[model samples]
Structure formats: C-alpha cells, structure tokens
Target: MNPSQPSAPVRILVIDDTPSIHDDFRKILISRGNDASLDAAEAALFADTRSAPVADSFVLDSALQGQEGLALLERAHQAGEPYSLAFVDMRMPPGWDGIETIRRLWQVDPALQVVICTAYTDYSWSETIRQLGSSDNLIILKKPFDNIEVLQLAHALTRKWQLARKLAARMWDLASEVERRTDELRTAEARFTSAFAASPIASTIQYNYNHCFLSVNPAFLELTGQSMGDVIGHMPGELELWPEGKAWLDGVSRGDRLRKHPAKLRTRDGRLRDVLVSTEPIAIDNDACSLWLIDDITDRLELEQQLVQSQKMESVGHLAAGIAHDFNNLLTAINIYTEEALHECQPGTRLHDDLQEVQAAGRRAAALTRQLLIFSRKQFSELAPLQLAEVLDRILPMLRRLIGEDIELVSEWDSGLPMILGDENNLEHVVLNLVVNARDAMPNGGEIRLALRQTVVLASQTARHPEARPGQFLVLAVADNGCGIPLEIQQQVFEPLFTTKGSGKGTGLGLSTVRTIVSQHKGWVELTSSPGAGALFEIFLPAAPVGTVLEATGTAGAGQPASDRHRGTERILIAEDDDVVRNMLAVLFPRYGYQAVLAQDGPDALAAWEKGGGAFDLLLTDMVMPKGMSGIDLARELQSRQPDLKVILSTGYSAELLQQGTTPPIPGASVLLKPYRPDSLLAAIRNTLDAAAAAS
Candidate 1:
C-alpha cells in the first residue's frame, strides 16, 4: 500500500511463424523494459517436454508448418502461462491457418491477447474474429505490419495486465485489514461482557417498550433466578413471578427513564425477596434499551426499622422527663414550705410531726424525679473539661458507699490521660450505672476496677464499632471481676427497658440512658463480656487539648452551695403566661423582701417596664407565649430602652434557640433553665443586680 513502491513489469507472449517477426517483437518489447523471450518450434517443444522457463515467451513460424506453431500454443496453454499478445502469420501451409490457430488459442486462454498478421486484405479474417468472440484483447494486422503498430499493441496489453494485478493486490490487503479489525472488536466486546457480568451489583438489559430482556449478566441471573433462555424473548411483564417488571415498564412508558424502586420478587422456588432496583435508559443504534441494577436491602431496611423504634422510645422518654422536671419544681416548693412550717412548731407537736413526714416524703419523691430526668436525657448537663484523677478522688467515697462494705473498689488512673470534655455529674452517673451493673452481675461480692487511659482509635479500629469515628480518645474503662454478661443478652443491654434483672430490682433504663448521653457528646461505648471473664465497659471520648486540664474543685456528692440570700427590696419584673405560676412568684418574691411586678406576656412585660419608669432591678421573662413576641425579643427591646437593665430569660425547652458558645449574647441577658426553685431564682436576680451596681 505504500505509494513509493514501483509497479511490476508487464509480460508479453507473441506466437508467429516468421523468425524476423519474432526478432522484431522481442526487440520492441525489450526496448520497453518488458521482459520477453522467443521460443522457436524445436526449443518450445523441448522446453514444454522438460521444465518450462518461468517467463512469458513468443513462438514464430515461416508461414509454413502451422501445425508446429499450433503445437507450441497448446504447450503454453497446458503450462498455465498467460499470453498478453499473440501475432499469428496467415497463409501458412500447415494443417491449420493463422486465423484458425488464433481461434483455437482464444479457446485455450480467453484472457490472452491475440493479433493476426496477414499479407492480403482477407474478408475471412473478419470471419475469424466473429468466431473468436468480440474481445478487446483480440486485434488484426495487415501484411507488412508496421513496427509502430506492433510496439503500440505490446505497450497497451502489458499496461492493462499490470493494472489488473495491482487492483487484485489492493483488494486482498483491504480484506485482510477488515478481518483484523473485526477480531479486535470481538475481543473488546468480550472483555466488556466479562467485566459487566462480574460486577457485584446485579445488572441487566431490557428492550424499551416490550421490556424483553436483551442481555443479563450473571449477577442478574443470580438475582432473578431466570436464565437467558427463559427471559430473552418474552416480555418482562408477562412473567408472573416479577410483579415489579410490569410497574417498571409502566414507569418507563410514562417517560421516567432512570429510577430507583424497591420491589418484592418471587423467585423460581417461590421464595420472596426484597430488592432495591435502579434502572437507566441506554440508547443503542437509536433504539432505547434499559439497564437495571439491583441490590438486596432487606437487612438494611430492617435495621432502619429498629432505629425508628428506638427513636420513638427516646421521644417517650423525653416526654416523661419533662413531666418529671415540672413535678420536681412543684415538690421543691412544697418541701421548702413544709420544712419552714415544721421549724416554726415544736418537734414533739402533732402538727410539726405531720409536716416532717410530708417534707420527708416530698424529698424522696424529688430524688425519684431526678433519676427519671436523668434516664430521659432531659436534665441539663454542666459540661466542663475534667481530669480522670480528680473525678476518682471526688467520687471514690460515694462509689464505696454505693457498692456497700462487702465489695472493694479499686482505681487505676493513667497519669498521661488527657482532659475530656464531659459533664462531671453525667460521668458520675456513668460510673454509678456500670458499678451497679457489676454488683448485680455478682450477687454475692466482687471487686470493681475503674481505669482511665489515653488511647488512639484508628480507622481500622472503627469498623467493629460502626458508630465510632477514628481519632485520639480518652478511654474510661470499668472492668469488674464478677459474673459476666451472657453473650445472648450483651447486645440487648443498651436497649431501653431491656434487663436481665427481675422487675423490682431494676428499671432497665440505666445502661440505655448512659449510651444515649455518651452518643450526644460524640462518644462511643464498647461492652465486652463472656460467661467466665468479667465484663469490660470501655467508654471512648475524644480527648480535649492537654492545656485544657483544669482540676474540678467542687465535691461530686453535693450541689453548689446556695448564694447568700439577698434581703434588699429590689424591683423585679416577671413575664409569664401561666397565671398560677405567675401568682406564686408574685407572692413568693415580696416575702423575700423583693418587689415583683407581673405581666402575662412579652407585650405586657414591655408595657409594665415602660410604666415602671425604669425602676425595675431585673427582667425575668418566659421564652414562649401566645403573642408573636418572644422573651429574647422582649429582652432586646428592654435593653435598648434601659441599657443597664438585668434580664434573665427562662424556657422549658430552649435547645432549638441555643447556639454553640460559652455565652449566647442576648442584648440584655443571661438565660435560666425553666422551673427554678425560690433560692436559685433569688440568687440569679441578686447576682445580676449586684453585677449591674458594680459596673455602674
């Protein structure tokens, strides 16, 4: 196919009687660079009898012995040699004349070029041509044929043969190229098919309208339980086992080309399976085909259902906690009132003793409510950077009391442990819950080992605990040499209301609440136990900065001491929509030597502040009310009017509004959690007024 290659030389064969004719033709052909050979009658016969030379040749006669030339032509024919031009001499005194010879030669090689030579203008020559058939290769010459004519015929015939050979070679190359390309295409298609079939997700191809399957990979066959023979030509919807096939076809007809749908399929064995199917439209040769990908999501869907159930239980727990919180506030007020009344009477008096019993009962009810709030995750956590050593130092005495005198408690603190961001009270609860579980695990007696260490959780380690993220963590491990949790019940230990303990022994919410609280703080809990070995509960919390280690100064067993009760007559504005709660505050504040003004909502509170001539020492407002205004908005307005006014915003559920910061700066204030005691309320008001006076 390279154009620079020279063309092959043309070959010519001339058969005639005269030696002079042969000489003339050879000279002409050789001059044209065409390789030519002359074979006399004797030589031709000898060459034909022996091995013939691999070259084109011309035979000649003396217009006599025509039988000899004819014999030579038969020899050439038998050899399968092509003759380009044959000039036969006419008027030969032989068995046959030149015209007859030409006719015979034409019969021998239809593609051979022939030219007749004669001395006379014979009409019989025309008759010979008619018998030989109308061929472009056949020509006639008058006697005394000019050399020019002979040379011209030789050149034309040779060029024609050359062109024919070139065309044939070109076609052969083209055929080879086409075959090679076809093989390559087949190989690529095979590779693609292998890759598609090996994919983990099930893949299939179906015709657009009829939904007839075009091709399905092995995964598809495995998923559908149908072979290529069963599915290829039939409409997918017609297959009764695949109900979703009909729905999928309907969706495609409505122009939804790509979709993700969940389906239930009946397999070949009549087993039903849940499948998630995704389909995409592929256009091949301008015809639409659909590609389907399927996944088995029954297990995943079931887990999600469990998660939803868990969330619902958590919601119920929150509702219970809110009720408990409200009830606790009422009990605090009742306990305080009863105690005050009891103190006024003599200890032996009947009324005094009755008041004492009421006070004691209220205190017990309040403790139960606090535990309920903790279980429901409604109790506020005072989170701070804490050291493990300090927590142990403070909580050991209480822990000893909790486990009783029979069981010994030991601690192992890693001195290199980093500070953890957590609530000290919640941490104590975590310790208490684990300790109590350990105690129950060993009904008789056992030692509780509490250990803390700095650890790193890598990405590889996170696989076992799917909820955990890889990072450096502070591991607080509680291991008890007690009877271990059973393998069957280990997973259920963190489920709310699930317990191994009998009904009266436990509420079954302790471990569940511990896990919830830890999760809220972006931490994870791991429980390891078996029948013989003691249980190990490892709590992993992300480590805080080392510089953040601040020792906790307060005792874990006691709340912060009440601030000095302020007895000064200070004007306090209270905004509350609840009339009963408002009336209680109004009567209670004045009894503590404070003037309390009332307002039903934000508007009324603002109006009362405006009328009070800026005389109020502090603004105490509820967060949610009937009007469009909120406590935050009212506080902003009050601050604008009286910049120095102290404000304490109160809310039952203010989580949605609280942003992440030490102090979310409202214009005039600090926020107080709702349902506060009289002492706490007085302390907050007193502190705010004192700070205001100091700033002035």
Candidate 2:
C-alpha cells in the first residue's frame, strides 16, 4: 500500500510435466522489463488524472511436477518470501494433478493470487471453480500462454499480496496494544482494593439508589463491631449503627448531602459513642453515591463539657461573693443587738429564754453567710498549719448531735498523720456541708463515714484532680450509703445552686461551698459513685511542712454576765457606713458601760476625731467605707497623731481590707468579723486598750 518504495519483484511458481514447458513459462514471466504497463486503450479511456505507475519486473521459479512445485513453495514461504502468483498445468502429474495442487497451495497461503494455465479440453472452468472455492485471488489462463498476459497477471496479483501483508501487520499491533491496556487497568484496581481493605479510618462507599454499602473498609466493621457479611447487602439503618438511622435515609434520598453529622451512636454491644460523620458525593456506576468518614469523639466532648461547666461555676461564684458581703453587714447588726439584749436579761426568765433563742438564730444566720463568703473565696481565712485529726476531735462532738439518731456518724483517723495548712472553721464547714449533703441523699437513713489520712500524689495521678499539683497531702474522705449521683450528671453537682432536691428541700450550695473552700486551700476533690451504690468524696489538701505545730479554736470558760466584763471611762470613736448599723454600735458600747462617739463613714469619723482634739482612747472602725478614707488609712492617720493609740477593725469580706500576704491590713490592730457577739466585741476592745496600756 506504500507508494514511495520500488515494488517487490513479482515471484511466480510454474508447474508442468516437461522441463521445456517449465523453461518456457519462466522466460515469458521472469525475463521481462521492469516497466510492465497494464494500460491499454480501455485503461486510457477510464483512467484518473493520477494513475499508478508500472510495477517492478517479475521473478519466476519452475518445478517439473506438482510435488516439486509444492516443495518449492514451502521453501520460499519459510524464507520470508513466498510466491505471490502461481501458473499451473492442467495435466501435470503421474501423481497429483494441477487442480489438486492448486487446492493444496491455496490452503497454505489463502491470499495467494493464482493463474490456472490450462487448455480448453483439460478441465471445464466450472470444474476448476468447484475444486477451489471461488476467490478474488484465482484467475484463468490459456495453455498456449501469451507473454504479455503472463506478465500482467504476475504484476497485478503480487501488488495485491503486498497490500494484504501490511494490513495484517497493522491488525496484529492493534490487538497487542488493547491487551496491554486491559492488563494495566486490572493491576491498578487490585492495588486500590488492597489499600481500601487495610485503611484505619472508618470509610465506606454506598450505592446511590439503595443507600447500601458497595464496599466497606475493615475499620468501619471494627467501629460498629459488625462483620462484612452483616454490612454489605444491608443499609446502615438496618444495622442500627446511627441515631434514628432509618430517618436519615429519607434525607439522603432527597439529594441532601450531609457533610458532617455529629450524634451519639450505640454499638452492637451497647456502648455509647459520640461520633462525627462526614460525607462526600461520589460517582458509582452512573449514579451519585456517598463516601463516608467517621470519627469517635466521646472523650473529647466530655472534656469540653467540663471546661464549660468550670467557667460557669467560676462566673457565678464571683456574683455570689458580692452578695454575701452586704448580707453579712446586715446580719452583724442583728446579731450584736440580740447578744446585747441577752446579756442584760436575768437567767431563768421567759424573756431571757426568748432572747437566748433569738441569739441562737442570729448565730446560725451568721454561720450560713460565712459559708457563702468562703464559697466565693472572698472571706479572710483563719488558716494555720494544723493536724486534721486534732481538728476533727473538737468537731466530732457537734457532728454526732447534728447527724441525728437516724443516721450513724463514724470517724476514722490515721495516727501521726501529716499536717495541712487550712482554716479551722472553714475546714469544719467543708465536713459539715458534705455530711449534711450525704444525710439528705439518704432519706431512709444510712451510715456516714468520715476519714482522715496522709497520702502522696504523683504527676500521673494529679490528672484525677485538675485543681491540684503533685505533692504530699492530707485526705479527708466522706462516704455515705446514700442515693448516689448519676453518671451522666456527676460533673454538674458541684455547680452553685444546681441541685436535684425538691423546692426548699436543699440550698444546693453545700457541695459548691465545699469545693470552693477546698480549692482556696490549694486542694482538690475526687468523687467515686454509682447510681445505687452511694457516693464517696475525698478532699485533698496540700500538706504543711514537717514540724509545723497545730493551732486550735479557743476554748470557752464559764463566766459572769458577758456585758459586765468591761467598763471604761475612755471615749471610743466609731466609724461605720450603714445608718442602722452605726446607730446600733453607738447605743451598743454605752450598754456595755462605756462612753461612745458615732460617725457614719471614714471622713466623718476623721473630722469628729480632729474636732474633738484626739480625745478618743481607741478608734473603732469598719474596714470597708463608702467614701473619704478606709479604716486602714484612718487608723494610720490616728496612730501617727497618737503613737500609743489602740484600734479595733471590723469586716465581713472586703478585698480593700485584705493586705499582701494573708495578714490583716492594719498591723497590731484587733480584728472582729461582722455579726460578732457582745462578748467578742467587748473582749477585743478590752484586749487592745489593755495591750496598749501594758506596752506603754
């Protein structure tokens, strides 16, 4: 088919019985000119403008018989140059005839162009056609062969054979290429399948029409604890792996693609897991599908919940702190007045008994407000390094009566336990509130256990208590066989005002105050509980240095009327902010048998002192004042004027009154918390004046 190269020589094979006939056929075909133009008058009449040029010369070989001719054709075919055309004698053999030889040769090379050289009497054309199936490669020739006719047959048939060979070669190349591409595609698919099977992320491919998994990774099976057989043919909803799984199928069918759907799922074994599922639209077999990626996020969500709750509790604590301060000031006035009335009453009288009841109620109110101040971390702590065991000894008597006969209160202490730096009253409140909370949990009554021991916390162990660091600590544990906190809401129980008790049944500040006070002492709380198994609360406080001595709450002694303890002629200057509280203080000391001067705030008291020419023996001042100067500044000025001036400072909770370190603002000044008894006020005043007198 290529037109540029010189054409291959037309090789011919001639078969006959005589050697003369073989030589005669070769001379006519092979010994011809290279330019063999088949163009005659008819060719000229029907030719296109560009006609094919003359073919190259013919090359011929002869065989004396049919067998010899077949042998010669086989040799040429194996040598890569088979004859394109053959001339056959009609009566060639004593063995095989030309008709049979032609049949055999056509079988060997089906495309071979042939000329049947025969006389009319030798065989009919119809018979020749019958011997070989009719084909374009076959041709007829007369036995008295013309040289021109033989040459033309050789040229045209050989040219047709060359075109056929080129076409076959091109077909072979195309088949090989197609087969190679198919193998490559198969290899790549195999690799992708292996990788999908081995993946760690939970991945799945599902059908678009049915929402069934087309393929699932091993991790997807592992996550749901389902086998491949359980997953493949079924929808995700069918297996109950997703929340309201059947409902989601409706959404997906509506062409809604869920990018990231987060929800809780229960596994096959019934473990709840928080998970995030993301989906991408994919194409599978002419329909759009989904590729899903799932992640387990249970622990992460719990930690985030803890962080949010902590921030909420902290915000509420700040608000409660301010309210507690103002409340204490009001309670202080009520308590002192009640105490003053009690001191004036005679024993064993109905009026005296009523006043005693009022005093007790006042003391209880004061105690409750102090706990509020402690929860806010605003109250000044009366902290000293003390033995928890010793502190428990004094509080146990009161706890036994408070717990009641319905519930048994048991105490266990480890002897020679380590010391902890803590506020005695505040620590006692921690135990009181925890025990009271425990008592409420058991309406039917249950045993409460109180324990004190020394323990060490390592860096790894400190994770259990987020507010604490690695250190030695004294642990105060309280356990009760009461209705326990639920697992889901365990972290919320310590939030202020968050309670499970019915209306008016509980204040809900009990555990919140316990946690707040313990945290203020650089300790942490740990809890362990089950729904019906009761609860255990352990308070861990940083241990004090070795050899630190224990401090105690002062012991009381039986005495005469508290009002008769102190009598002074000296003028006492009082500085207070609230009008009712100021008036109460003004009338109070005079009842105690001492002269009193009254002023509303710091500036008023200072002006009164200057106008009186410093005639006061002692300055009685409130720590937090509305305007002018604070009690600390007032005391500083008064002391400068009279170096031996005695002083007493009163406060509930005030940031302004607290100094650097845990010490009181004014050095050498006596301090009284709000709502103090007439006896306590009288004692502090008497002690300050006496100490001044003794020092001078």
Candidate 3:
C-alpha cells in the first residue's frame, strides 16, 4: 500500500479458447530478454527513447475459459496478491462469456483492470458498454493487434492499475484515521457531559453575549429551587436569581475572571441564600459562553452561625456557673443566719418579722440565680419519668391566678397518655413561661388554651422541621387568642434577650428559658402565628419507652420537718472552696447531731480522710473545687479506700453534666443542690447514711 517500497508485479490474467494468447501476453509483459521485439515495440510506442521496457514488470496467468479466469482472479485476491488486469476473449465457449467473467472479477476485486480481447463482432460497443455498465477499468483490444499497440495498452493500463491501487490504499487509511478521531471526540464529549451533570457543585452554562442560561444541571436547579423549564433560556436577571452582586457578573462580562465571588441569590421560595460564584470562559458551537459554578453556602452559613451561637452559650454557661457558685454560697450563709436570728426573736416582734423578710428576699435572689444557671444550662435537673397531666394539674391553679382574673385559662389533655422523661420542675417552668407570654400578648385580656396529646413525627415531616425525626412524641400545645407575633420577628422570639415588650415590663428571658429547657429535655418547640391572628406554641417531647418503671423524683425524707427529723452523730467530711460555705456547714452539722470536719477543697478533703484513718461515714463535697481535684475524683478515691463512704456531691453547676463520662459514678452517691436550707441539708445527710446502713 505504501508507494515508497517496490510494488508487487502487476498480475495479468488471459482468458481465451486458444493457449497462444497467454504466451503472447507473457512475451510482452512478463517474459524477459526473449521478448526483445516486444520490448523494443513497447519502448518505441511509449517513446522509450529511454531504455528497453522494464523487465518482469508483469506476472501473467493463463485461463482457457471465462470461468477459469474468474477463478484465477478470485485466488489472487484471496492470496493478498490480486490480479491488476484481466484480458478476456468474448467468444469463449462452454463457459461464462467475457461479459459475465469480467462482472464476476469485479465483484471479487472491483479495483481490477479488465480488457476484452475479441476478434468477432459478438457484441457491439454499445451493447458491450450497456452490458458491462460503463467503467474506466474496462478496455477493448482488437484480435489482430500490433505488437507495439499491445505493448502500449499493456504498459499504460498496468500503470493505471498501480496508480489506482495506491490511491485506494491512501483513501482507506484516510477514512480509518477520520473514524478514530471521531470516536475519540465522541468519548470526550460523553465524559464531559456526564461529569458536568453529576457534579455536586451546582453548574450552569450561560451565553456570554445574551447572559441567558444555556443549560443547568440538577444541582443548579436544586440550589435555585427552580426546574429546567424555569431556568433554561432565561437570563439570571429575569429569574431574579442574583438579588445582589450584579457587579460581579458585569466584571465577568468584561473578561474579568470571577473566582469565588461571594453573592446572595433569592430562591424561588423567597429565601436569600449565600453562595460563592465562579466563572470560566468557554466556547460552544463557536458562540462565546461562560460556565457558572455556584456553591450554595446557605446551610453552611447557618451551621457556622449555630456554632458561633453554641460557643457563645457555652461561654455564658461557664460565667453563669462561676457566678451561681459564689452567689449561692452567699445566699446560703444569709438565709441560714437569718433563720437563726428569727429563732432567737419573738414571732410578734418587728425584728423577727424583718428577719423573715430578709430570708424571703434571699430566697428570691437564690431563685433568680437558679434561673440564670438554668438558662445557661448549668442548673442541676432531676430527670425522671413524669406524668405531664399530673404536673399540669398541680401548676394550672397558680398559672390561672398569675394571668389575672381578666384572662380566661382553659386546659384539656388526652387520657392514658404516656409519661415523658424530664425534670418535673423544669417542665413546669416551660409551661409557665408559655402561659405567661400568652397572657401578656393580650393586654386587654384573651382566652389561653392548653392542650396535650400524643404525636408521632414522620420522616417526611423532618424536612420541614430539621430538629424532628421519625419517633413517638408528646405534644403540649398552648394557644392564645391575642395579638399574634409578626412573621418578620418570629425567628428572633426565642433568642436570648430579644423581646417586643417595653423595658422594665419584661426581662425577655421567658421564651429563651423555655427553649433552653425544652432543648435540654431533648425536645423542640414549634410556633404558628401571624400578626392580628391567634398564636399557638407546641412543645414536642420524646415519649418514654414502653414499660419503663418510673423512678422516685425525690430522695427519702426529702421534705421532712426539722423537729420531726432524726439527727445523726456520724462524722461528715465537708469539702467546699468557699470559706463562708465551708464554715457554715461545719457549724450547722453538729446541731443536727452530726460531727463535721472542714476542708477547703478536694485535696484537703482527701488528706483529712487519710489523717482521720478513713473513719468518716460520709463525704459532702462540692462538685467543682480547686487544688487539682474534683468532688467526683475525691469520691472515687475515698470509696476505693473505704468502699462504704456515703457521698452527697453538691454543686451550683449541673451535677449531671459534670458527672457524665468522667468516671463510673460513685455507687449510691447522692447529689445535693446548692443554696440549701439547714433542714434540707440535715435531711440529705440522714437519708444518705440511712441508705448506706440499710445496704450494709
């Protein structure tokens, strides 16, 4: 096929009734030296004023019949050395004629050159032409042909065959190369299309001149809350996708590269989304285009804000814990000494009454600090399975009176409701806060309704409320027919310190505390309201698992009267960092018939236990203390030594939170909240000792 190399000899096939014809062709085209006359004739005919005709240029094969010639052509082609020219006699008998033979030859090798060598007028030129269908490969030579003419025809037609073969090979190679390149292009196009459509980054193609969207992938549609029908062939301005950052697009239009340009786009749902838009210049169908990669950062930004808010709340909790610790200690001292002063005075006297007032004020201050701790999630809560109906029954009378006689309070709940695991007191606060807010919404007075029922959240519902999951829940709905909340400010209603009420009229902590308590209980709150319409707040709490036994909410003898309580003479180790709290516990324990030893911190308490040879029956220690140890650590170490040391771990911080994953909790260790009364403290010590005694 390559022309640079020597070509194979042109194969010639002679089909005739006489064998002499084959010899003649050989002498002229193939036989060398013996065909001097033929060579000279060919030279003279072709103007070979050059040299004798090139020798052995043709390979001749003999066939006596048209069928034989056709068979020879087929054999040569199959052998990869096909005959280039076939000379056929038209009047061959007992076999296919020249016309039929030539036609069959062409079917096997259409590129073969054929010449009809006929003496008789078997078929006219018109008839021959009509039968063979005009072809440049066919030629007619008369029977009595001159040697020179024969040589000339042989030389010219054989050269023509060589040129034709070369051209055919070239064309074949060219077509093959074209097909390969086309396949490669098709594969590349498919890969690009697949990758673009499947990319997680929302991508679109826009016509640069028109600024209209040419194509958008699924992620692009999802990010914009639009469909293909909505976006395709539409300009971004027409879709209002870019509410802001048109300047970024303008710069891109001016050939500036847009890389991660921060922008805001309003989705079809009318919510603004934060996004990073990047662009690439490309050409499609010779039309200038731009590729827009949009990274929707709406959820990402919300999560970032939530993380910042969480960190802020954690810092606030730490600060509140520190404040509550010191303040509760001070309150404890004031309340205890005031009670002692009251006991020393007559009930009718001014001094006794004033001490009572002072004690009441101290208690109120303690309550406020407790609220601060609770809002910061540092307050100790006693979690237990509680009947919501029972808790509401006990608190509704107080709530009714708090809302004033002008406002009507209505309550209803489903019977046989499942219990929820939460702190009863905290759940009470949640209800109280919602009811109070409902009351305040209507200055002119309105109806406040409370409804409770079981609810099951489905997976589909979780899409609307991210905090919800498929599970059983108890919903407490609080509805108020009052001036409902405006939609614009609804999201901020639960944020700390956000309020619509005038200064001094509200502290803005009610809903915030409600949110905190609900979250701590592993629940969520949903609000339905519109300005000038009624508002409804629903609290969803997880239901306790079936067959869960309810645990006692209070310790034994928790609310026993002081005069009727049994006194203990057991030795107590009191570990508190606050000097006043430490001294007050030391002085008060002995009056309850309990001997007390004082320690400033956990390490001091540990050292005192070793000094006393582990004789103490109880360890009352602050949960958070200085000197490289905490109350939990002290209890773990002392219980290891004595194994019977009863512990009452106390803290102004959340004792439950502090004890989590710190160590396996000291077995049978009780927790005591700070700002304690003398009676409560004595009762805790007595009950703890009694429990240990009973266990022993």
Leading candidate by TM-score: 3
Model 3 weakest lDDT span, ten residues long = 1-10
* Candidate no. 2 TM-score: 0.63
Candidate 3 per-residue lDDT, tens place, 211-319, comes to 8899998999988899899899999898998887677888776656788888998999988989998999988999988888999888989899889878877887678
**Per-residue alpha-carbon lDDT of candidate 1 for residues 401-486, written as tens digits (9 for 90 to 100):** 88987787888885766777787767787888898898787778888898888888888888868688888898888888787889
lDDT of 1: 0.70
Clashing pairs in 2: 332-675
Give the per-residue Cα lDDT of candidate 1 at 679. Answer: 63
Best by lDDT: 3
Question: RMSD, each candidate, Å?
Answer: 13.7, 9.3, 5.2
Quick one: ranking by TM-score, best first? 3, 2, 1
lDDT (Cα, tens digit) per residue for candidate 2, span 1-696: 211222466577878777888776655554434433533521453365145323335677887788888889888877767787787877875868878888888777776778877776667778777878778888888868776666556656776777776676676677777878888878877887787788776888887688788899988888889888988988877877776555665676555677668866767887878888777777766777877777778778988988987787678767876677677777778887777776678989999999888878878888888877766666756668877798899988888888888999989986888888888888989988888888888889889999988888899886786686888988899999998989877877887887989999888788888887887788889999999899999999989988888555554433755555566667899998877688887787886678888888888988898999898899998877887588888899889888777888888763433764344476788777776766778888877887788878
Candidates 1 and 2 compared by TM-score, better number:
2
